[model samples]
Target: TQGKEKVDDAEEVKFEIWKKNSDKNSSMLEAKHDQHGIYTAKTVIKEPGTYTVQVHVTARKMHVMPKTDLSVN
Candidate 1:
């Protein structure tokens, strides 16, 4: 939410990830809650480079997408 509160009862959570500027390596996966106020999704990328990860959160009729960049090294 706009208040930055915790969403413990989300209807769905997903992660859209890809290597920057490359759609061939892109993937979208449903995230699983670890029951620790955190969600996780895993994928194997053999190549090492920079990538973008976008988190999609849906709950209580609201949806938020937050993205960030990371390096695999």
Candidate 2:
């Protein structure tokens, strides 16, 4: 979802969520691939704060990391 291109069949995707101030407060979830190369991950945020969501993609012997900020009310 972070990249413009579609994911390849051999690629592996992971979704990571973490608190902005703490590396220990992090969660990693494996993404499920759907039709049309869409990858999805669901997580429940119990705390209301600023967090970072990163997409870790591995494909073609390379790794790509894309991250975004998320604020949960």
Candidate 3:
């Protein structure tokens, strides 16, 4: 027997990119999603340093935020 599953809603995904120790230079990532629930955003780094990328997701009154460090040369 197969079980039925329902997807009432989906989580909103967003990203924030900024250089380390700099708050004024932060920018929001414009992400696009496909039918497979994959989100993607494109950005260009003009400086060479350590940067932070944060992924924010919200769904059903719940929120999740994850961050990572990135370096560009």
Candidate 4:
């Protein structure tokens, strides 16, 4: 994920994924709907560390952002 603003379209699900490791930085990403109720995206994480992942979802004038942590081995 990187610092890129996603222009949200109407009536569509907009996903902006933000990732930052132990090092303070900026990034973001998105994925398509492959299965029912499931969204998938690919990201290249080479460094092994703790990453703060903030998920931003916007759809039909509804916006929700949740933050979590990811540890890579």
Candidate 5:
């Protein structure tokens, strides 16, 4: 998955990917923060199974937050 974020402040945004079916105790993928706080992460699946993709977005010292859900077949 890939995404981009636009910010007016100089603060940096962090993004991470995790599995929804799991206990939410670990991350499946993590992307490095760019200059614009945008990032991209990849998840690999070998077997035919259903898995969910979770995207978490957070900014430094900011209240603005967002999340997204994705499905993989």
Candidate 6:
């Protein structure tokens, strides 16, 4: 997944991934500075299951950013 963002004020942005089926777990995949906010993640799914991707943008405050769903076959 790739896109552009227009932010008024922000210090940092984070990209993360996790197994959607599992509730007690989350993984930190990548992080980027507020200025150079370009990022990518290399993830491995062990089982055939659903996964989630979230982008967290933080500056003066924090936001949930966006979410995505992935299916491993």
Best by lDDT: 1
Candidate 5 collision pairs: none
* lDDT for each residue of candidate 2 in 1-73, tens digit (9 for 90 to 100): 3367765463789998998888657799999887777788998999899999998888767788889999999
Which structure is stronger by TM-score: 1 or 5?
Answer: 1
lDDT of 1 by residue, 1-73 (tens): 3367766688899999889988647689999988745788888878798999998999889899999998988
- By how many angstroms RMSD does model 4 differ from the true structure? 8.3
Global lDDT of each candidate: 0.84, 0.83, 0.73, 0.56, 0.49, 0.66
lDDT of 4 by residue, 1-73 (tens): 1125343342333344334533446466665655544555677787776777666666556666767877888
Question: Ranking under lDDT, best-scoring first?
Answer: 1, 2, 3, 6, 4, 5
lDDT of each residue in 1-73, candidate 5, tens digit only: 1225564342333444445666665454555555454566555655453444444444444444366665556
TM of each candidate vs. truth:
0.83, 0.81, 0.72, 0.63, 0.43, 0.58
Give me the runs in candidate 6 sitting further than 4 Å from their true place. 1-10, 32-38, 59-64
**9 Cα displacement, candidate 5 (Å):** 4.8
User: What range of 10 consecutive residues in model 1 has the weakest lDDT sum?
Assistant: 1-10
Off by over 4 Å in 2: 1-5
Report the Cα lDDT for candidate 1: 0.84
lDDT of 4 at 1: 12
Q: Model 5 residue 13 lDDT? A: 38
In candidate 4, position 42 carries an lDDT of 73
lDDT of 6 at 62: 55
Stronger candidate by lDDT (2 vs 6): 2
Stretches of candidate 3 above 4 Å error? 1-9
